[model samples]
Target chain A: MTILSFNNIEKHDGHTIVFPSFQLSIESGEIVGLMTSINVRTVLLEMLRRKIPVPDQAIAIDGKSIQQLGKSYHQRVGILSIDDGLYERLTVKESLLFYHRLFDSKLPIDGILQLTQLEAKRNVRISKLTFSEKRRVHYAQLLLSDPDIYILEEADQNVDLETKRVLMKVVQELQKNNKAVFVLTSNMDSALAVTNTIYRLDEHGLHKLDVMQQEMEPEDEAVEEEPIVQPVRFEKIPTKVNEKIILFDPPEIDYIESSEGSSQLYIKGDMYQSMFTLNELEQRLLPYGFYRCHRSYIVNLQKVREVITWTRNSYSLVLHDQSSIPLSKTKMAELKEMLGLK
Target chain B: MTFSLKRTLAIFQKDYKDVSKNMYVSFTVIVPLLMAFLYGMQGDMGVDMVYTVINMSLSLVGAYIQCSLIAEEKEKNTLRGLMLSPASTLEILAGKSLLTFVTTILVIVFSAMIIDYQPENIVIVGVAIALSTLFYIGLGTILGLVTKSVMEASVVIMPFFFLFTFGSYATLLAERFPVLKAAEYMPNTQLIELAKEVQTGAGFGDIWSYLAVICVWIAAVFILSYVTFKKRMMD
Candidate 1:
């Protein structure tokens, strides 16, 4: 049965109309990809918010007049938004717990946590966690909701190969459970890799590629052989295997830097932002008063004000101007010692 | 009811938690405390009649602060996460209002204790406070929901704080100023009269007419707030 279907769906903002008309559908156990280079994620979120209604000829969620359903519509729809405002100070477990409350009575908590491999980092705060870990937390929250339909936006951003494998496993599990998956991406590779059913969107419109029925055969082999030895590549002494350095060929530090109180960081490379872990970065920059105040953030010591204990040594570090950074329970004493508070 | 109570209380607790951590929220609450302390020392410095105007004025300020708090949350896009949850808009509003009401109650209790203003009829005093609170809180919610940003909500409500405080204070001014004497017909005057009568241990009979006015006003404001909330939720 079709979980969601949209036909001749048109949308308009107060100023302009974007999608003149669009058609889409998802059945149980199907993996669908909505591929548009434009800002489709925002539109989909708006449609989910019902700020923009679905097309007139569409059936959404059990063919119910979902307009009346209100928040219940969210029950069967799990959205992993690339634009989700991440509360970095919150622990991975705490973050999941917050969303779990909303999605309660829908999925078992333990199962969701296990599926996302976040059980180990349950106590680790997100600011202290890795980018991949944060993405895992977001994915876990979505999966734990156990929605019949899943929507992902730029989902591959933080995912490492292992995490991607886990997510694909999750997609497989959801499909096995008859849940429908819908992923949206600007990356053509991700679009092809994750889904069989592709809705290729452009200015003209969307092209629904029927890869599932094997209508489009594999066009060409993607891999082109790299020469055995390019002089510069070999001269670079491929000795140090740093992902960022390896992936991005930069001879030196080229970056746009921004400061958050004591913390100073730069966005390097044009494609993506990069930074060492606060833990790793803090060690080299301790003389600069840049200390690991939170797991995710290394604040400049100049910003540290006073420390207030949250619940039972779940400490909160107030900045010079009284802005607060959360201190994990485990790191409270270490932080105190580091700051000479002890 | 369970969701309302649980979610409201949870939100209220978190507001306090956020308050404890945020210097700004702390500053807001502490400013009143500090002002109340400063005001206490200047005993009878031409302000003995403050008890007459303080109640309603404080109530409005309380409500405005409450509205702005939620307004900030909305501006942060933080409310969307809660709005998308199982907590319906009603529950969310209830929760927001509950947080505001609690803050209001604390400020009132502090004012009463510090100012040495005690009413004769505690029940009537309580009811008047409750009604007066509900009226302005509903106003705050509507304003908060409609505002484009936190700064906008505050500016939109800035006149209200003055109107609610000074406008209602006209009830007490009626005794001294002839112009304000005409305010006896105003609903605030009736509520103030009710507050005064309660202090004198008067019966509810003396206040029933004003209570009726209070009821009509409350019903109207509550309806407006409900409609605004429903519209925002739909959006």
Candidate 2:
């Protein structure tokens, strides 16, 4: 059995703290969702990769410190990050073969291909595959390794609904094998869809969020016909500007950018510091037409005046104020469809 | 951690397959043979030209191939996958170096054959070439670690290539400018000097210092490259 724990883990970037005294434990057959803010998700992933040394055996795997497990720890833990680190030139079969050889595993290639639904794509070079197909290839590598613990870092982002379904199926299979899975994501809906136990990470530490009991019950036929509408709340966001606290209407803000681990809100030709992270702000302001266009910038869709094509794959969003924000290449088509731009 | 030959060989096999499909790597191999053929056509394939070709093939071409391969992995972000694998650092390093070493040795030997150059003591020349190959491969790995992309690697490695391969002739100016004497300690310079010693039927005892110097250079370069690589991996 595998047991992964974080006991009072603290991580700081210079003077600002990312994770402050967080404690959690995950065991085999359990899938835990770590709801991370957008600003700190990348930092958290980097910390996890380094396996930051925890005091008093705070972080342990299988009753042993990861440091003690040494190089062998990697064999037991598989990581699937947003990058999907894959060799683009190699065909799907060759890529899988290379990883199989690395682990020296006797697992059959056919089994992995079937599990990932990539049997037809086995001969295609990874460069020619779609984004979703590439993600499945990453999943195939994970399934082939069959690690005891799987770390999914923003696995559902930039992927289509079908791909998300396939990934959830893989997670279920992993759970059936009694493997521990830790999912770090900013999307609460996606996180709640996979795991009942959710931990919200914030300034104080990780807090358990109570899953709504209504979600567990089957909807009545009458209720299905008349869906209940959620009340829209447009709260004034509190921001800091030059040590002064200010409350600004959410709709007035043009966008928010993460600068030096803090969110900067652009409003009315001025910038103000926001205490809420980009992830928190995104969730709060999403109802007001705010969309996360890039890793660092969240643009107010209503404020976008034009979409400029910088290159065949690169794009930038120009706001009404003449300020520009980067648009992710993968999100371009979706943005165009949303804007009704043919 | 125990060193696993099986894992190392697996990496070597994969790298061989990958390199075979890479046009840049293929060109690196052919460039040296082309140079050798040109020299053979001129019918002036003397010991000086032979040593120069060996040095160029092992140091210049070896560094280019090794650096580009590693940098390409970094560009594609696949190095992190390898680093996060169960393979130990030694296994990965040895595996990568083994491919470069074998390819470089084959090129060196083939170039020599084309030039009809035969050393008086084959064993001595082989040892020198082997040590030189290790040194150049180490240098290449260092270059790869320091470069962020394959384009940057190609640009950054040019100075080192010229400095090492052409720097041996600095000995000609050593008589007039004593400052140039330090160039004799460079790996390529030692390789050329050792090759000359072997051509004149020098034994192990006669060229032991040159061998020692080359080995020291290799060790120093390997240590530096390993330290930088580990640092980059962690970051």
Candidate 3:
């Protein structure tokens, strides 16, 4: 079931447009990530939190308008902001129990603690817990609320790796329970870590980011094994933005992602679309120290900073700026050999 | 908005543990008891002094503690968490106020014991005190809603504390300054007046006027707090 839906959300800050007619719908058993700048995220969050009604029945919970829902909208949509907001004096168990009762949740206290992985520190005061532990307590509170739709704001930000993994697991668990999850984060990498249905919202409006890397193909590895060395037709990769073709040096490009068949070149943090296909770009840029890290992604080798092994088959290449690109298992072995690492 | 005693008690229980551990707020609860002890040593304290200690307890524990609790929640942003919970506004407010209420009543009882206050009608005095506590809690709620942090709450609450707690004494200057006469209508002053009337064998009928004033204060403060809370909900 579709738990939350909003459309035609237009907001103007004086003469400037904050959001020029935006819309989104989150269904049960789905996790959607909306990645944007901090300013855009703040505006989007304000709209969601205040339920500022717009024309054409824009915001709704289970198809009912926010106005009709009134304050009950909060009961159906739970948001976890960046701040943990746990009482420093209250123990983890005490805090979760308090929210449990407030939410009228029948879920056992120990069950929530175990889900948040805070059972060992159940009796410890929030003040004594580490920063990540406090974040877990906050997640525990939201879990106990058990809203139909969960909107998390930068849940993985500024936490330890363990906490990030714990949050990812919790999101997966929520999805399994048929709860719709919408994550709003400024970091693309964090959004990718959580879910693949990612969208970027900005002044230009909302655009879905092609974050899901195509599954590895057996024949693609053979193609990579034999590099087709060709003369570099042009060192400048051409991309179009505002109808202006901006030529970028091969080294200047951080990565090229093909989403829904069109190639997008990411330089610094900005995105520009290229006219070339991913396969063509891969063949053209291979001599310029670019590698096909994933079926949908071609990354500049100089920009690859670290190789993160998430699981036996899952890997990601962390760029210098901390942005990540998916690395297939076979490609990982090839990249390791290219770096002369046995 | 449905009210749930179970949810309210859950909040009260959480606050009970929270307040006990928060030394900055718990220390304010002791101020009235210490004052009562000092007054008890004086032997045969006057009615004004006895009411002064009781009013101090109401203002300090009732208003100050409630304000700090709400302000701290706002400071840490937990108030938003609670507001978004399934609990109703009344439940959250009542649960939070219940803690301050229990602490204020306990202090009032202990202070009465220490000062050996024997009123003509305990029932009437208790009613006045109870109404006045509601008034203070409302004041605290408004104060907590207006301020963003616990430190800001502490600073913003000082003027209200002095006005409500010492507004009764300010009435003595009414002859010299007629503007000060308005202070006589403060709930704290009405509580003191009702206590004095009870000491003189005044029945509930005779003291209903004083109770009316405190009730008005409660109604006004509660209405204002509700408005402020609604405004702050989005802020």
Candidate 4:
């Protein structure tokens, strides 16, 4: 499957054309690297901005015109800018939540928090954090959004060798999951590390180079330890699009069946309240916090830090981070009774 | 929830953070507050203090803030990060201008409240501050686009700050010397309009005229700055 295809893509900036004509595409489950001089970074960024669909000619994706699928293209396409695009005021978690809202779905954020190894620093402001730490948060954000086509600009610029390998492993994992990766690298070595197909964007235009198949031949890595297996292939399995939306599975509430025959808990944030269905959630969370706080919602008593009285007839729940969730009139008394707050 | 809003908020929050930590933050918040007090104390200070501080608060401070923001980001190589997002130049400018406009209004309110100086038409005063700040922020953004460092932002902005202080000569001359009528468009013009509106309860017609002038300036400068920024992005 062709996840991304750019044909005869030209970009102009009033006076002069930045990219004259470019043609490129990445196969499904392939990680292609784009190597170019540092001078081209600004122009390339402009190309993405203007989305100059044709280099004065033509550009398309999966045979559909780029002009037709413009913003739609962006839905599955994520661009990692030259600077990591970290909001300094946002703690790592807030940053993730902010981007999560854009995906039109609430994500299981804790996994990404842990995957990026920023859990310990989750609460710290990004501005006060170190460069590498900030970059980690940046990468984590890109991952959590989970785009099928990720355009990474200079992915290996500031990290250590160990971290670079970890990032490469991540790209491999993404590729294994059938995501097409477009990497712009100034370092040919870094570009060669993760890519089978490589291209160069230069004065002429974008040139698709032959795959560096010499060293990457599959048979060369035959180790006695185990067969170096290729990634699993589902022939004609269809792209992630036209496929069912996969809800991100996060850790579910783990609770023992209470001897008292009911489990009540507190889970805070408008985030959870919106994601869980009151009735269906009631069945799944019977052993947990699925206590009917009101007709509109349920609460996990364990997650609540305090109950805040909003007004004479209204109240809000204050959770761990001081984030509030509204309680319906009926839910409040039930919640209060459950907590013996009356 | 669309990409643009997410991107816009990201830009907004990021710029907000950058400004909050700026050493100049104290100057922006404190200078207006302090000078507003000084303007109220006509015993030791004269109307000149009122003119200079109030003028600078509404006009120069926002420009300085915008200039400093661009310079700081350029120094950190962070502007390139924002340019690469899938947002149009208008969206970026909208977010930035909104931040600049809101912060500028804060300075205006602070100065107005502390000095016991009220505008003839509060709405016109609002329109004036918004237009003037928008104009100046656009101006400051152009300065930021042209410069290399945050400190350089001060150099470009200081002359205007000084003008609003000494530019009163031009205003005094405009009062008596018809030859100085040519200089009315200088920094003194905005201050004179504001002073007239504040003291004499002038009609909103003048404020509207001034706002139109400021709007034109903002539009011209914004287009120029955007072109410059875009050219830089293509570099």
Candidate 5:
């Protein structure tokens, strides 16, 4: 059994901090969901791939520092991103065989082919395979390596319902095999469905959510002794503006503007000072069609009118109110998916 | 394990299979042999032509093959999978280099056979060609790391190929222009000079300095390529 721990880990890109002193631990037979913004996810994956130096006692696997493990550390960790990094010319069998040989793995090829249900497409070139088939091939390749830790980024994106089921089944199998799985995804429903534990990664650090308690709060609180029915609770976020506190319904807020470590809520032509940090507000409002489109702005998806591509790398979200909000280039695809554009 | 020769051989075989399917890479391997055949037909199979053929084989074909193989990986984004694998950087480098090295030697040997060029000392000529091949492969790797696509790699490698191979001809103009003599110190020039010494029956002791110069060039290029590759991989 392997255990991976992050003890007060801090990561930064130059002066801008990405992960700020977060502590997390995952052991075998558990699936952990890490929900992070698109930009932070990109930077985090890059750091993990490069094996950037970590502070002493910050990160450890199996009770040993990752830095001290050297190349052997990768042997225990497997990563699967949206780009599976497959060679189009290579057939499914040949691709798996190549990785198997490169890793000097003892796992049998037939077992992997069977596990991924790719036995019928063994001889088919990756280019000829469907996107789901290619994804399965990537899972098969990862199975050949048989790592103790699996990190999957955006595993559910652009996949059909059936493919998502197959992926979830694979995740279950990995858990049964005593593998620790960490999934980073923007799809909250899928994450909530498969993962036993959920954590939100914001500017402050990693915050674990009590999934069961949050889900049961409504029903449990409504069980009063009286026969009278309780009114449905509409969640309201309180904000302070000019020494006065205003209760604003979350759905009514068009966007939140963050500057100088403070935030302001824009609700129907009115601005109010926000008591919470942008990170905290993002977590509280993400389920309500709000997306952290940029570092300083979180726009409600219902209010977004059009997406404007100013350049190849620059993008802006035109809201219904004719106000433009900056969108991260890396988050464009996800935003499109969220908007059902493609 | 940091590296394994068996794993490296496995990667080499995979590369061979991949290259066979790529028409452009296959054509690159054939170009040098075609040049050698043309030189043989024209009766220009002298020591100078032999050096030029060897230079073309190493710098032109070698650079294209190595650069394309790597750039294609980056284009396909499979290098990241390899990097994330248990295989060490040394194993990947050695594995990829093995195919380039073997194919290069085969092209050079076939070219030499077609030209009917005979060296007084076969060992010295082989060493010189091997060292030159290593140096060119290192340079090719650097080009591959910096290029974003196979087309970019081809465009970037062309000017360097000409400057290293055809640029040696500048030594012939050294008497008229003193600054042109500096071309003699180029890696390809040193390789040609070493090959000429072998043709004139020079022993190991007589050509030690030339060998040293080529070795230094090999060391410098290899170090630079490795550094660049590591940095690019991180980025």
Candidate 6:
């Protein structure tokens, strides 16, 4: 059952458009993740929290319009934002009991403490707890609310491995109770680790991410020498900004450099991290006027304005942005042959 | 909007625990009682001296404490958590204000007792004190909503604190400076005036104007606070 949904929603700040129209639907007993930037997350969370009022039919809870449901809609949907904001002076049990009464939740306090694995810390003040332990108190508040749909914003961010495990376990527990969970995060790895139903939202639109392909990457590399699978060509190179995957067209990239065994794509002075190694990126970008000018660099031939030979052993390729990339002495010969310049 | 005593009391109880543990805010409740005791040592307490202590309580225990509590919520971003909870706006505001309200009244009663100051008309003075507490709470709410942190709230509340706590004394200079005459209309000044009238055995009908002036301040401050609270809710 679809517990919460919003469709064709548009948001703007003054004359600028924040996010274009998009639709999202979360079904019961499922966990979904949306990957986007912090700016987009702020806009999206506001829309989901119903702070930014949409048109009459834009948002719905339990298949009814949110405006019609009014404040009662909040009871069905609870948002666990990055800021847990627990009272620092209160004990864990005291804080949980307060929310339990506020939301009129029937869940026992001990049950919540056990679920979040804070039973030992129940008597500890929030000010005295660890960062992750405080986050567990946040999860406990969510359980105390016991809403049918839980909207989590970066629930796994900046926590220890144990807290991450506890968060995942809590989501699984919610799914067991047939509750819907929606996670909004900028970290692609966090999204993939939490659930398979992940989507990436950007200025373009919302696109479903293929988690199967992502998980199969390591296996694909392991089986590469066997040649059992055919080579697949991709025109768009995927790079990441703040853990969000952004697919960039080959023409938009100025150069690619390998740093610490990972590929970095440069475009107009801004660096974006790519998951592909330098060799893989070189192979994929070769047809798009790109050449491996150095062991650590691949320069786009179209953007190369000048090739400076400082010495017989030292060479550089200068692009239109006035940024120079190193050119290997051997690859200098290859570039000369490709450019038909002796 | 739904009203739940269970939820309100839960918030009240939570705030009670929170305030008791926060020495920065909880210790402020003792200021007025201490002031009253010092005045009692000097001999019979005048109505102005008694009101001086009561007005200090209104600004300190009422406005300053309420402002710190709400600002602390915003500072820690806990206000958003409460706003998103199933509890209604009324429940949260009433629940929070109830603590400050009770504290303000208790301090006022203690200050009155410490100074051996008795009102000829307890009903009239009680009503005035209650209205004045509401006014201070409303003022505190507005300050809390405008400032993002408790530090900012303390800074922003300085002028108002002086004006509300000592604004009544501005009337002492009203004859020297014609512009200072407006201070006579301030709620704290009206509170002082109301207490004086009641001491002279004035009935509700005899002192209705002073009560009405304080009521006007309450209505204006509450309206602004409610609007500010609504705006902050969206933020």
- Worst lDDT run of 10 residues, candidate 3 chain B, spans B79-88
Residue-wise lDDT of candidate 6 within A1-342, one digit each (tens)?
999887787777788776778898889999999988888898878777777777987888877888788777778988999965889999999999899899998889998899899999988999999998998899999888988999999998899999999988999899999999999998766776668789877766777764443332355555667766647755788876443456778887999989988889997576879989999988888899999998899889999999999999999999998999999899989889988998
TM-score of chain B as predicted in candidate 4 = 0.83
> What DockQ would candidate 4 receive versus the native complex?
0.10
DockQ of each model against the real complex? 0.15, 0.48, 0.62, 0.10, 0.50, 0.79
- DockQ ranking, best first: 6, 3, 5, 2, 1, 4
In candidate 3, stretches whose alpha carbon ends up further than 4 angstroms from where it belongs are: A212-265, A268-342, B175-179, B230-234
Tens-digit lDDT track for model 5 on A116-146? 7889999988889988888888888887888
Each model's TM-score? 0.66, 0.76, 0.79, 0.62, 0.76, 0.83
* Regions of candidate 1 where Cα sits further than 4 Å from its true position: A8-23, A39-45, A55-57, A68-71, A86-95, A106-137, A157-173, A209-342, B1-16, B42-61, B168-190, B230-235
Worst 10 residues of 4 chain B by lDDT: B80-89
Task: Compose the digit string of candidate 3's lDDT tens values, residues A1-342.
Answer: 888887777778889877677788889999998877787777777667764546657877888877677667777888999964778898888888788877788788888788788999989988999988888888888888888899999998888988888898999899888999999988766777878788777766877754435345466667889978877656767775442344667887899999997999997677878989999999889999999989999999999899999999999999987899999998999999999998
The superposed Cα distance between candidate 6 and the true structure at residue A79, in angstroms, equals 1.7
Off by over 4 Å in 6: A10-21, A53-56, A62-68, A213-291, A296-342, B230-235
A-chain TM-score of every model: 0.57, 0.62, 0.67, 0.56, 0.64, 0.76
Pitting candidate 1 against candidate 5, the one with the higher TM-score is 5
lDDT of 1 by residue, B129-219 (tens): 7787777787887888888675787678767766665566565566677887766654555667677676667888887877888788788
Q: Assess candidate 4 and give its TM-score to the true structure.
A: 0.62
Model 4, docking class: incorrect
Interface RMSD, per-candidate values to 1 decimal: 3.0, 1.3, 1.5, 4.9, 1.5, 0.9
Candidate number that wins on TM-score, 3 or 6: 6
Q: Which of candidates 2 and 4 is the stronger one according to lDDT?
A: 2
Residue-level lDDT of model 5, residues B156-184, one tens digit each, is: 98898788769889999999999988899
State which candidate has the highest DockQ. 6
Better by DockQ, candidate 5 or 2: 5
Better of 4 and 6 by TM-score: 6
Query: Which CAPRI category fits model 1?
Result: incorrect
